[model samples]
Target: MNKTYDVVIIGGGLLGCTSAYYLCKNTDLNVALIERGMLGMQTSSLAASLVTRGRATRPLIDLCVETFEAVSELEDLLGDKLDFNHVGSMHVAQSVESATAIAKQTEMLRQMGDHPVELTIDQAREKAPWLSIDQADYIVFNPKDGFIDPYRLCAAYMQGAKASGNLDVYQSTEVLELVKDGAKVTTIKTDQGDFVADQIVVAAGPWINTLLQPLGSGAAMAPVRSHYWITATDPLYPVTSPVVILPEAKAYARPEVGGLLFGLRDQVSKWAHPTDLPNSLQGFSFDEDYEGWTALEEAVEPFLEVCPSIGKVDIHHYISGPSGYTPDGKHVIGKAPHLSNVFLASGCCGAGVAISGGVGQSIHDLVTGQTPRIDLTDFAPDRFGDFDPYDEAFLTQCAASRSQKKAG
Candidate 1:
C-alpha cells in the first residue's frame, strides 16, 4: 500500500469491491481496499445470489432495481460476462396469511412502476409443472428477477477499479486496528503496515463490529448462520427454472446448474462472533451443527405437496456461511456516529449481492460529501445505538427476532 491515500476501505466483500469500483470510476480520490482473505469468497461468494426486486419497503425495492441495472452493465464495464440469468422469480404462498402478504408486496411493486403478476395455484402450476402448487394459495412473479455468478461480479468490480489508475487492492492483508485521533480516524494499522487516509469505510460483513468496538462506535449487527442446499440434478427443475420463494415454508430456491439451490431461514437464528471464526472462508462452515437441518426440514416439508420428488432428491451440498444482520432486519449504512470520516456499510441480512450496487453507490456518494441516491433513514449506522458485540444472549435474541420477521 502507499504511504498515505485519500481513502482506505476495509473488507473486500461485494460491498467493499463495488464501493471501490464506483469510488474510482466516479471520483478523483486515491483509494485502496484491504481484505483479510480472498475477495468475495466469504459471505458474498457463498450467497445464493438471487437478484429479486420485491421487498417490504420502497428504498429496498429501489436498491434491488438499481443493483439489477448495475449487475447487467458489469460486463461492459469489466469486459467479461458474469453468467447472469434473468429467468425471473416468484414468491409462492401456501397459506392465507402469506398470500395476503404476497398481495401487499405485489401492490407495492406495482406502485413502484414494476410489473409483478399474481398467479393462482393453477396458473403457477401451468407455468412450472414441477411446482407442487396445489397447496399454494398464490404466487407473485417478477420477470426482472434473476441470479448471477457472485464471485465473477466481485472480480469485475475489482478489475474495473484496478484499471482506473487511482485504486489499489490488498488481499490477504488483515487490518489490526483503526487509530482514531480525536473525532477522526487518522491511521489504519494493518499486518503489512500502518497507512493514513483521509477517510475509512468498513464493509467488513460479520467483522464490522469487531473493528468498531475499539473505536466506541460499535453497532448492533450480528453474524448468524445461513445455509442453502443443492439438490441432485433433476430434469424437472432445469436451468430455466424461475427463482421460487415459499414464504409459508420459510424456504426459497433458485435454479443451480441443472439442479435446485434450496435455502431456509432458521426458526431460532444461530449466532457466531468474529473471534470464533477463521480469517478466511477456505475451510469454514456450520457442518458441525447437524441438528440445524431440523429447521430446514420443517421449512421445506410443505414443498413436498408441490413437488413430491423433493424427498428423493439427494443432498448435493449444504452450502453454509455466516451473514451479518441487525435487530431491525435492515442494512446498516451511512456515516459512523461520533467518528469523523468513518462510514459503514454492512448488515445485509443475507441479500448483499442483490443490493450491493446501490449500497456501493450510496457509500461512494457519502464518502465524497454528496447526498445518497436513496433515503438512508431506515439504515443509519447509529440508528439503534451501540451494543455489546460479544453479548450472546442479547445478540441471539436479535438474531432470532430477524428469523421471526422473515417468517411472519
Candidate 2:
C-alpha cells in the first residue's frame, strides 16, 4: 500500500511526538508520525524527568524555560494537568571547583531574570534531609524546577496532536530507507508501505544515522548509555522533596514517593557501537556483562556523602537507555545542510525531557517556513564539522560528553 501526507515524521519518540503536537496546534498540515514501536517507549521513557531551568548554557536554559511553559500551556489546552510538580531543585557544591560552578550557574540564572535563591547549609538541610549539607560549601535552590513522568508527557503531546484532527500516528511502523529525489526525500520505505510527503523530519534520536546515512547526511551524535538506580521507599526521602543536583559528586537525586531516584556520571561512559543498537529497545540492551555494577562502584562514592540513605535501602531497580549525545554536549537541531527538506533534532545529551518543547517549536517553525522564535545557530545539525558517525574516535568523543556532564 502507498500513503501520502503533507509531512511524515520519523521516530515517534519525544521529538517527533512533541513536533506533531506543535504542528497540529498551530497549522493545518496533515502529518503522520512513524514509529518502530510504541510512542515514547525508548530513550524518552528512560529519563529521570527532571525539568530543571538551570542549565550550563543560556540557550539551553531558554530551552528549559520553554518546556516549563509548555507544561502550563498543555494543561490549559487540554484542561488536564501533566505529571509536572513544582517541587523545586537544590544544587549542592562539595568542593571549591563545584562551588565556583554553582556560583556561575546562579549568576546565569539571575542574569536571565530568574530568582534562584541562595541557601544557607541549614536551609538546604531542612529542605533535603537526606542530603548531607555538612559536606556542602554552596547551596542554591530554584523553586520552579520539577520532574514529570516522561511517558505521560509524551502521551499528552500525542493526545494533543490527535485532538487537532490533522495528525495520524502509525505505531510499529519501521522506516527502512529514505529514498531521495533530486535534493528532497520523496519516498520513505517503511516495513508497512511507502510514505510520500512534502517534508520529512528525522527526529529519530540515536538511530538517526541509520535513516540518513544513505542520503550522505548525518547528525553528529552517537548513542551514549545513561542509567539510574532507585532506592527502596524510606521516610528520609519525603514525597515532596526537591530535586537535587550535586556537581562535585557528579550525580543527582529526586524524590519518588518516599523513595529517591539518582544517577551518576561514571568516569568512563559507554557508547554502543552503532551496529549494536537496534530499532526497537524491547529485547535489546547494552551488552555490559556486569550490568553497570562496575561503573556504579566507581561513580557512587561521592554521591553517598550527600545522600547516605542510599546505603540503607535495597536498590529497587536499575534502568539504562541510550540518548543521542554529541561531541560538544549541545543539541543538534535545524535543517540538514545538504538535505533541504530534512530537519535533525537529536544530540540532546540526556536533556531531552528538559528541552522537548523548544525543540518541537523550532522544528515546526522550520517546517512551516516561519521564523524561529529564538536563535538556533548553536543547534545547527552540522556544527561540529563533517565526521562519520561510525568513526571510533568520534564515538568516544560523544560518549565523553555524557560522561563528564556536571549539570543536572
Candidate 3:
C-alpha cells in the first residue's frame, strides 16, 4: 500500500464513510479510511435511527431536507436500496408547554410542505396500539419521518465509496496520533504504521480529541452516553405503527419487527475525555445512576394508562454508546480551528444518522475546493473558539443539548 494519498480519513464510522463516499463519487482523489474496529459498528450502529425531517430551526430543517435528498441520490447513483422506512412520525405532547410547541411546529411545518395531520387520543392509540398516550393533550403526525437499519446504511456508504476504485478502507487500524508540521497535518501515525495525505478529515466521533488535543486544539463537543431498550418479539409493535415522540417524557419509540424499540433520555450525563474513555464498550457500564429503573418505571406508568402492556414486556436487549453533542445542539463541520489541512465533522447532536448526507457532502465540497450546497456559517468547527472539551462545565452544557432532544 502507498504511504501517500490525496486524502486520508480517520474513523470508519458513518461520518467518515459518508465523507469518503461523496469524495469518491464527486472527485477523483485517492482516499483511505482507517477504523479501529469494524466499520460503522460503534456509536453509529448503537443509535436509534430516526429520520425526523421537521426541525425547530430553519437551518436544521434544511439540513434534514438535504438528508432525504441525499438518501435518494445515494440510491439512484448506486442502484442499491437503503430501506429507509418513511413510516411517518407522531409528535405527542402531554404538557401545556409541549402542546404549545407542537401546535406552533405543526403550523410552521404546514408552510414547508409538510402535510401534518392532527390526531386525537384514540386515533394515536389506533395507529400505535403498543403506546398508551391518553395522557397526551396534543398530537400531530408527519408521514415523512421514519427509521432505518443503522449498520446496513453505514455499510452502503462504505461500499459505494469503494466502488469508485479510488477509496481504500483499513479496518481495525487504530489511529494513534496526528503528526502535524507547522499549521498542517501531514502524516497520520496509526498503529498500522504511518501514512501521509495531502488532506485529512477527522470524523472520529467521540475520539476526535485524542488526535487533536496533542495539537493544542479540540472539537467543541462532548460524548454523551446515548442508550436504548429493545423488547422481545410482540404483536403490539406492528410495522405499520408510526414512530411516536413524547417530548415531556423524553422518549421515542419505533417498531422493531414484531418487537418494540424505545429510547429514553437520561437526565444524567456520562462524560470522559478520549484519553480516559475505554477503548472497548462490550461490557462498559452506563447504569451509574440508580434513577434509571425508577425513571423507566415512572415513564412506563403512562404507557400503562391505557394498556397493561409495557410494564409486562420482557426487555431483550440494551444498547448504549457515545454520541458527540455540542453545547448548542448543532453539528460542528468545516475546517479544524487552526489546521490548514484538517477538516472536522463532529458534534452530531443526536442527529448524525439523520443529517449524515448534508454533513458528508459538505465535507466533500470543502476538501475539493468546491462550495458547499448548504450554509456552513452556523456549523463552523471553530465557532466556540478554544475551550477544554474535557472540562466538566463544558460537558454539562453539551449534556443540556441532549436533554433538550426528545425525538429519535
Candidate 4:
C-alpha cells in the first residue's frame, strides 16, 4: 500500500464501506478503508435491517428516502443481487397515547413526502390477516418501507468500492493509534504498518470513541447491548409480510427465514465501554440480560393476540450485540468538533442500516466541499458537548432514549 492516501476511513462496517464507495466514485481522491477485523461482521452485519421511510424528523425522513434510492441501485452498482425486501411496513398504535403520537407523525410525514396510509382495523387485518388489529386503535402503513439483508448490503458496498479501482480495503488491519499534527491527522499507526492520509473519517461502530480520543475528540454516545430473538418456522408469516413495529409494546417483528424475528425495548439499560469488550466477535462477552425476557413477554403479547401460533413457536436464537446510542436519541454525524480534515459518522443509535447511504453521501459532500442534501445541524458531533461513557447518569439517559419514539 502507498504510504499515504487522500482519504482514510476508519472501520469497515456499513457506514465506512458506503462512505468509501461514495468517496471513491464521486471524487478523484484515493480512498483506503481499514478494518480491525473482517469487514461487515460487526454491528452492521448484526443490525436488524429495518428500512422504514416514515420518520418524525424532516432530516431523518430525507436521509431515509435518500438511502432507499441508493440501496435500490446497489445491485447494478455492484453487479450483485442483494436481498432487499421491499414488502412495506406497518406501525400500529394500540393505546390512546400511541394513537395520538401516530396521528401527529402521519401529518408531519405527509409534509416530508411520505404518504402513510392510515388503515382502519378491518383494512389492516385485510392487508395482513395475521395482525391482531382488534386492539389497535390506529395504524400507519408505509408501502415504501421494508427490510434488507444487512450483511449482503454491506458486502455489496465493499465490492462496489473495490470495483472502483481507486479504493483499497485493508482487512484484519488494526489501527493501533492515530497520530495527528496540530489540527490535521498525519499518520495512522497500525499493527501491520503505518500510513498517512490528508482527511480521515472515523466510522467505527462501537469502537469509535477509542479512535476519536487519540485525536482529542471523543464520542458522547453510550454503548448499549441490544438483542433480538428468532423463532421456529411459522408457515403463516412469509418474507412478503410487512414488518410490524408496536410502539406501545416497545418491540418490532418481521419475517426472517421461515419464521419471525422480534426485538424488544426493555426499560432497563445496560451500558459498557467498547474498549472493555471481548476481542473476538464470535465470543464477545457482553451483557445479555436474560431478565429482558420479562419485558420481551410483554413486548410480544400484542403479536400473540394476532398470531396465537406465535405462543407455540420456540426461539431459535437470542442474538445480542452492542450499539452506540446517544442520550437524546439522535445520531452524531458531520465534522468532528475542534478538528480539521476529520469527520465523524458514528453513533448510529440503532438505525445505522436505514441511514447508512445518506450518512455516507453527506460525509462525502462535506469532505469534497459541497453542500449536503440534508441539513444535519441537529446531528452535530458536539451537540451535547463532551461526555463520559462510564457516567451512570449519562448512560441511564442513553438507555431510556433507546426506545423513545421520535415524533416531531
Clashes of 1: 1
* Candidate 4 residue spans exceeding 4 A from truth: 108-114, 288-308, 403-408
Sort all candidates by lDDT, best to worst.
2, 3, 1, 4
Model 2, range 53-88, lDDT digits (tens) per residue? 987667788788888877888888889988687899
Candidate 3 lDDT tens digits, 97-120: 888877876777798888999998
| Residue 268 in candidate 4, Cα distance off native in Å | 1.1
Candidate 1 residue-wise lDDT, 1-408, digit = tens: 536999999999899998898898888899999998889888888888888887878788777777877776777776767888988888887789887877887888898788888788777766555677556677788888888888888888888777765997888899999888898988899999988899898998888877888888865678888878888989877788788887766777877878878787777777877678777765675546554466567656655666666788887777778888788888888998789889988888888989888888888889999888888789997787656777887578658755765421
User: Whose lDDT is greatest here?
Assistant: 2
For lDDT, candidate 2 versus 4, the one ahead is: 2
Which residue pairs collide in model 3, if any? none
Q: Which pairs of residues clash in candidate 2, taking residues 3 or more apart in a chain or in different chains?
A: none
The CA lDDT of each predicted structure is 0.80, 0.86, 0.81, 0.78
**Which consecutive 10 residues in model 1 have the weakest lDDT in total?**
286-295
Tens-place lDDT digits, model 4, residues 47-101: 7789987776778777777777777677777666686787788888888988887
Candidate 3 C-alpha error for residue 280, in Å: 3.1
> Against the hidden true structure, what lDDT does model 4 obtain?
0.78
How does residue 6 of candidate 1 score in lDDT? Answer: 91
Assess candidate 4 and give its TM-score to the true structure: 0.92
